[model samples]
Target chain A: MAKITGQVQMLFDLNKCLGCQTCTSACKTAWTDKDQGQEYMYWNNVETVPGRGYPKGWQTMGGGFKACTNQVDLSAPLPSINRDYGAPWEYNYDEVLTTEGGDATVGMLVPAPRPDAPNDYSSNWDEDVGAGAHPDAYYFYLPRICNHCSKPACVAACPRKAVYKREEDGIVLIDQDRCRGYRYCIKGCPYKKIYWNPIVKKSQKCIFCYPRLENEDPENPLAKNFCVTQCVGRIRWVAYAEDTTSNLYKLVNVWRVGLRLHPEFGTEPNTFYIPPLSPRVTNGTAPRIPTDLLAEMFGDNCSQTFEQRKARVEEVFAILEQERAKVAAGGTSELVDILTSYSESDRIQL
Target chain B: MPLWPKDTLTTGRSPRVLFVWGANYLNQAKGFLDVYQTLWPKLDLIVDLNFRMDTTALYADVVLPATSWFEMWNLNTTDLHSYIIPFTPVIPPQFGSRSDWQIWQGLADALANTGVVFQDSLPDGTTITRDYATLGTDFRTLNTDGQDLSDDKDACQFLLDSSVETNGLTMDGIAEQPARLLETSEEWTSDLLPNQAYYGFQRMTEHLKPLHTLTGRQQFYIDHDWYLSDFREELPVYKPPVDADLYPLRWITPHGRWSIHSTYRDLKFQLRMQRGRPIVYLSPSEAQARGLLDNDPVEVLNDHGSLVAHLCVSPRLPAGMALMYHGWESYMLKNNLDDTSGFKNGWQGPCTIRIKPTQLVGGYAQLKFRLNYWGPTGNQKDTRVQVVKYAGTLP
Candidate 1:
């Protein structure tokens, strides 16, 4: 079942996790910061899986679910995102004005590093917080981000030809210079990994460390992608997602595909999950569930389960359903025309 | 001092920091150490202030309630150029919530209340400075040429020809302000510094130095190597703690993106990510092998305290590790945490433990109450909610 791109996925066993957020913090520190991060972000979210996911309505809200189909419409204008998704382009014109007698000087130079307070306090201040609540309680974190599907919805929804999926490894990327910030891709993507940057005013998401991925050192370039490498609990992993000779991906799809994350949403997200074994299910001997689900779940890029990708104009198409602008006044059904269904390979174009 | 936090507080010899860092800010923590090392303090005994309630607090002498980021004066303009914005009260100090400055202010007022006045001004007086208004209220009304603009805009203004002091300002010609942090290296070259007050302090500590202390200007550092006897022959010498077993888990509890410590716990929007049950996270495989569940409730136990949460199984974490976002409360539960709940206190102070026994809105259990009393307990199993969204980065 290996995909054409030879891409594989991974699954994490929550029971083994100690909730030591080394992976989450390491990622934020290593990659999610810097000017590129801020507005359009969350390359990693260590969400409590027992609740609603990190992104509010990503699964059922976007385009609803659909079975895979091959024909995708390339020329249709892509969908739009939530109105306030970007922001008010406030002008930081502080420099444009000057104080009369008091010159418009920088006035002060703050320290790059603040002085070490004798006592630096924070919220989680206990020596052993979150301990001893249940006789046999289990609380584990699930790190989430862009799955970079073998067939990326973002690549299909771009009107500006701004997004592309890398051929070598199916990592989806946005060319900032080419992106007009139409926000169409953001809405179309079920994963919602793409983000609109207010500073640069462009879309951004995880790059899968392409530069590091192509390096000759043999070790994953993002060997230190913050999370995988620096986890104090040793619960993380880093490997070539393409090669299935590894046990990571094979275990995911083959051993445990029944436990899926919002599968009804049709993005074909690459990140897979070995559903948490609840106390009820595991009251019996939990199957010696293979430790490696990474390759099995997503290792196959050409999964036939994903071939039928572009049958559009379904009712779940939020923006196209006039969900973007409250359609009070009468206007041509821009939706019916743009997303008008056709049997051509591009099928329902929108 | 052990770079890695010691299981027990390090004392009698050198400084040891039990840095309770947030996974959301690993770089910020590392960046902090790189700078904090420059100004090592005299004595050390530590208990970090991460959000989770399980870290050891037995060693802490005074459990002072502290201010959150938004609660304080967070004045920032440009990169390094900015003025201090006075801290404004947000929600009437979440029951017993107190600012770090107020803690000192309260201590100062208490000390004064006892008639034992200390030579130093209140410790947190510098939370923000009225450095400008210090000259006098007339500074705001004064005209360009030093005329009282209250009377007439075209009035003939006059510079004070003689030395005159009213309140803190003087009639001695206008003082020139420093252009930036470090305009001249010579100013930082010597120990003797300016006598005038800048911000709130009169002395020239690193805070008052020119901004470019990055070039070895006004930075502070201390060498604790002399106090170490357990050093190995490692080149970049570091002494791993001998008592790592006392607290095996390198404790970390991060704040919610917008939750100010214990605040915003039971609020509907905030609880969306977590399905109403306190959860600790682990890999699914571990949960399976150990009879754990995708969303099974469990107790997080350590020497200091314990918390109850739902299980989150995913590959996002490493083995033998777990994490719980801080600011959970018993009040978040539809049913209050009871003795039968088998839960223990994970954290206290910071208005977190400020609670009253009130009936839960939905259920028949009674729990401790507070402004926003959050704890680690509940029956949230098999739940997932979406919490964030974006404009147009994805297709």
Candidate 2:
């Protein structure tokens, strides 16, 4: 293992995330557009929660550790290219377009399934299709990327030692040269962030825009990740986890508002999210998003029972409501100040 | 074309030329079937200028390639925003394409070479003269400022110098950062602050300025003869949709999340996030009742026309509504081996163009012909359709 120098963390404020896919588009344009197998890969994707996420039911697909144990769940399944993550289909533009004096027989321009990835399901196939029916239906955008965990399962599962967390920034990167595309990392990763690049015969994941952080371009030196900087909602904050003065640290440690996703997975993801607050019903009887659902996602069950986890979620929601009420009433709140500030200094401090 | 009807009433002449620019009117226009069948044959020429091979270009007599956003020098401003953003070319136009300004300049030059003068006798017995020989020269405006306005950058600068809101601003200044408009225009009903949020009708409400109306107090009641006739719609009233008897479900076409109209709709990355094609959303119960499961091909139709697309059974939507996000090109919804819903060519097959008679009234205050503001908006929301499970054979 390399010397522990630093670990950067990200804080995503779910309140503001609109799931516009601007960040996803920016990351795709910056990194993965040209590569053949990377066509289906969205290093940063926004999925509508309370829905089957990218790769279908990734939450229940199984991976990481079992409960409080460090043992990797041997029953972890690999996501299918066609069934889970839909193939990068091509449009029949040539046949349908009128550039060549038109083809009257051909119908509208539609997706022609790629033979390599003939797929029916897409990365966001269940978009906006939240779990309940009609008025009770609820959904929120969850923009995800490689968590860059302190103990990444991709690093542990790789027999070739190709996948490693950087000592400097804690960015988990797959060594393309060493990667043989065994795909164990894909099975081991609980978040399903790791993707198999069939053309390159290597495993790939989000690099956290390490080159931008390295200040490679003298003309436009960007210290923050492309996704964080290009985020239209300004929902993301990136900073060193050890920097107590940073909002990422304050939100996760001091304020206790940001919680890691599936903490019981035991990878200790560096990514922390400010859980989405559900609207109280018309009569203020129950939450639009059930507490049990929120708990199922963000609750840390390794340290407590499911009931306790649900209580914790409720407690956090209450705290958020209280702080919001205080701010709405023309009062002051440090948490609100931290979240509301549009300054890049407050959000992305390297 | 409908609003600015040339030689219609006074001249008693029909329009012979059509220039469809940027917009995909054939694909997006409501009651496009009427335009194609009734209006199209009467036109002598139809020219389309666009960066993409949009549906309008498919039917055009001549298709002129226009430079894209990244390949053009232009100024961007909208009624919704307070700032004027400048678009400086990142790269030169490729594949013999030219900017819109240059394309029109070329057309002027071509017309000048023909030496044909466009002369029209007015109703007052005076002749309206447009000498084609001097058109190329006049188009560049070299006589006034000795600057060839045919050049896109020069044209952009001339626009900046001409507009009172952008008079002092330069292309370079806006390129660095967007320049705020010096004053608000009538089109924008709000006063623009430096960085504050815009609240419409602030001048009328806060400063007591009279609005552009007869009574000037946000009056919706229009007691015009047209409004009082058979409709009696002087005040707002919910009239049942005209197509209610034709179909069972309302087709609500909302703006798409993946693409802005048809812009990036064909991109592989954008399509990968979606179901790889255009899809229609229905309530779970509705889908089940129609025997349509997720990813099942379905045909949505009415008296207007029909369209074929895969169904997405979603609980998020309400019953009695079939929601299809807008901007899917006609070329994308064909009846092929994969789709046999019997629709010939997507939404391009045609739909309703139900224009309210009250909207045609013009003599009243604030009801005059204002481009996009006060006009006969084609009531597309009232369009009704029946969703049925497509019994098409799968590959």
Candidate 3:
């Protein structure tokens, strides 16, 4: 048994995932298409994971300098972190030009860094786009989003206390009313998920369909997370991974069902994944000899798994045999069924 | 006006004229100096390059504080993309920044004092790119000229208003028809083309016909059949320098929202975003071997010079490679701090050193002091080794 912290998490098997981007499109159709929600980003993105980050290089852009938790300055890796502070800037490129020879070159213009790096760096920064390309170059799309961390750095980093981790589901949320756009939370989050709505100057993030959760009670067919509901690969599992003995917990924590991008930072992130690491199984049109270790971690049915895995280019079709069986069986003897049964009764705070 | 001797060029057998350069790539754009020095026989040429100096304009014995983009209004017509984009700013620049046009205007005046006057007018022309003569019905009332390169603020306003065009779109009324054309083989408006593009940098034109304005008429030919090269036959011709140590690290700092390289380094908000020093990006596999962490302060030294930066450890880089971002400076108007106190932490500005424009430093700005995230580049990365032999199947 575990404490009902009201913290819930979702996990996806990256090994089983195909990067169809259905999840992204689904969210766009459900939320971002709306006026107020246009700028509000969501709970997930399918990054290349190892190489190119989603929505460009969100990582190298740097947000906060999370101070180490240890009293002494650490040469070795430490557990927690502190936010790094730096100045922000705005620009206008047309402030210094006059027309000549029917051509007007820009003046006083310092534009922001462009989308791609110099030397024509692509999202797949490593792969060459033109001439003598690698024949067997491989990359698997890794969908990523806010991890709904157990000890969210964003909540602790907000000096104004504008952010709160819901006691019910443990979901991190921003109080738009109280937020003054200090961006401390933005700095504190190692993930850099939190963003300032340039229009309203408040903080916002994925609500996990809170309105739908309360109204339709989650059990209702209409209730769905725009990102999770639309995954074609069916790899997205929107479960309350609280119970320890269940397969969900085992897969996420022990078998490490999902791996973290990095753990040394120690944000206690909730998102977990079965990585799309294709280190082995190199060469040949098809891998005749499956990497034994990879097959074992995933299962003996490597043929079926790889066959289905290969079809993961479009994420809208995720319902493989394993997932179909789980959904059809109608609630396993897992902790989730027990917890949700009591969900209505307790005034739970995450 | 600053005073100087008229015989400054003939003071010695040959006087060294240090030419300050930004990223012009064109060595002959300033060939006028070579012509002048040959006639006068008094100039010894030495070109000093400041890779990304937005603050100072280095000319042939001429010094100008180039006005930044925010300091001037701009109108531009892309000969390649074929459309005019008007760039306007919300706020005036903070201090001594001046536009390139103004600097050239001054150079023209200076040359005039040397008993030379350049013609201030050029021949009129038209491009078959859009058949500019037949662009609109009345030229004033009808506006759809079929182009996608305009960044006019009125474009956003047009999206909101109810103006109709000959094609029944408001954008056309403002002479801003999108350049999207049907593909040669596929259904014209398919997602195939859209898939190749990024968020804002979408290509509007489908068929890249050789623009006619510069040539006086539209020239149609297969993609391969064009006599297109200023210095060579290739479009992006890579001309390696004869002197290897002259320039290395084909540095490229694409755009970001914080602002272009040197434009925003002065303001309090943006100053925090820039790197205090020029940061050279290295792959993680390269760093691990050299004993550097993702944020560990390390020096990226080449034969030309060295730049210090926090390591950005990511798997994206294959190996035997590094990168650096360009543009940032104090502009001399902002509060200046001595670099002695904050050496390890790094200083924020346009270059590695805060020397006056007259004296150049071999570096770029930091943008900001923030932690950049990269994926676990490899199980064990070795960044320093020059030869990046992939150690085979690393995590």
Count of clashing residue pairs in every prediction: 138, 5, 89
Indicate the DockQ of the complex predicted as candidate 1.
0.02
Best by DockQ: 2
Computed on C-alpha atoms, the DockQ of candidate 2 is: 0.61
The full ranking of all candidates by TM-score, starting with the best, is: 2, 1, 3
Task: For each candidate in the order shown, give its overall lDDT on alpha carbons.
Answer: 0.39, 0.79, 0.41
Q: Over the stretch A191-240, how does candidate 3's per-residue lDDT look in tens digits?
A: 65665555676766666666656566544443456676666666665656
CA lDDT for candidate 2: 0.79
Writing each residue's lDDT as its tens digit, candidate 1 over B66-104 gives 546545432222222211122234444454655544454
**Predicted candidate 2 versus true structure: per-residue lDDT over B1-395, tens digit per residue:** 14334456787677788899878877787775567667788899889998987767777788899988899899888777677888889999999999888999999899999998788776666789978898899899854576678778878888988877788888888888777888776656777776786667877877888888889888888777777777888888888777453687878888888888777766767777778777889999999888888887887877667777788888888899989888777666645322354444446343577777777778578788877878788877777788887666432
Candidate 1 residue spans exceeding 4 A from truth: A1-8, A18-20, A36-40, A70-140, A216-224, A233-242, A253-260, A281-350, B1-395
lDDT of candidate 2 over A1-350, digit per residue (tens):
58658998898998899988889889999999988999888888889988788877888888887775777775766888777887677876666674554433354565667322246777777788887767778889999999998878888888999999889888899998999989999988999998888888888999999887887555544446889888888899998977889988888888888877888887888898888887776666788887788788886435666787788788778888899999999999998999986587788888
As for DockQ, the candidate ahead, 1 or 3, is 3
Better of 1 and 3 by TM-score: 1
Whole-model alpha-carbon lDDT for candidate 1: 0.39
User: What lDDT score is found at residue B175 in candidate 2?
Assistant: 86
Ranking by lDDT: 2, 3, 1
lDDT at residue A288 of model 1 (Cα atoms):
26
